[model samples]
Target: MGSILIKDTTREERERIVRESLGDGFDVTCGYDDAGIDYQQYIDGKKELRELNAEADCGFVVAHPEEQQKGCNNI
Candidate 1:
């Protein structure tokens, strides 16, 4: 099991990703940051977006932009 990191996107895009991020028997969790307010708790209809903040650009990130993949599978 692993995680997918999505950043620098809009709510519509995020929603789309979230929709596709899940499938039959597949489990995935996703969330983003709005300025300083984390969105994981608010995504998936858990919360609603009242105001759109222009400063938000996926601040709550999981993997870093320069994060390296440590795949355990050997060739």
Candidate 2:
């Protein structure tokens, strides 16, 4: 609801935002899940959530003829 910009939020707020967005994938006691680890940049204020989400969206499998799996299947 409020601003999620790095300058606008405290480190704690950023952590809470990422954790809540991830739902059960995150553990308050154990920390980030494998999928959740990508948000570390957001938590550290090195990047915004939008930037991270954009990177995720842009993900694609590169062609690797050497591997049995090719293209999107590589993902």
Task: Please give each candidate's TM-score.
Answer: 0.25, 0.60
lDDT of 2 by residue, 1-75 (tens): 999999999989998997888786675445344434367788888988776665563434547757644443322
Deviation of model 2 at 51, angstroms:
0.4
RMSD of 1: 13.0
For model 1, the superposed segments whose C-alpha errors exceed 4 Å read: 1-7, 24-75
lDDT of candidate model 1 versus the reference? 0.42
Query: Where's the lowest-lDDT run of ten residues in candidate 2?
Result: 28-37
Clashing pairs in 2: none
Angstrom error of the Cα, residue 62, model 1: value is 22
- Tell me the deviation in Å of residue 44 in model 2: 0.4
lDDT of 1 by residue, 1-75 (tens): 232223345555555555564443333343343244344533444443432233345455556756746762232
Candidate-wise lDDT, in order: 0.42, 0.70
2 in model 2: Cα distance from truth in Å? 0.4
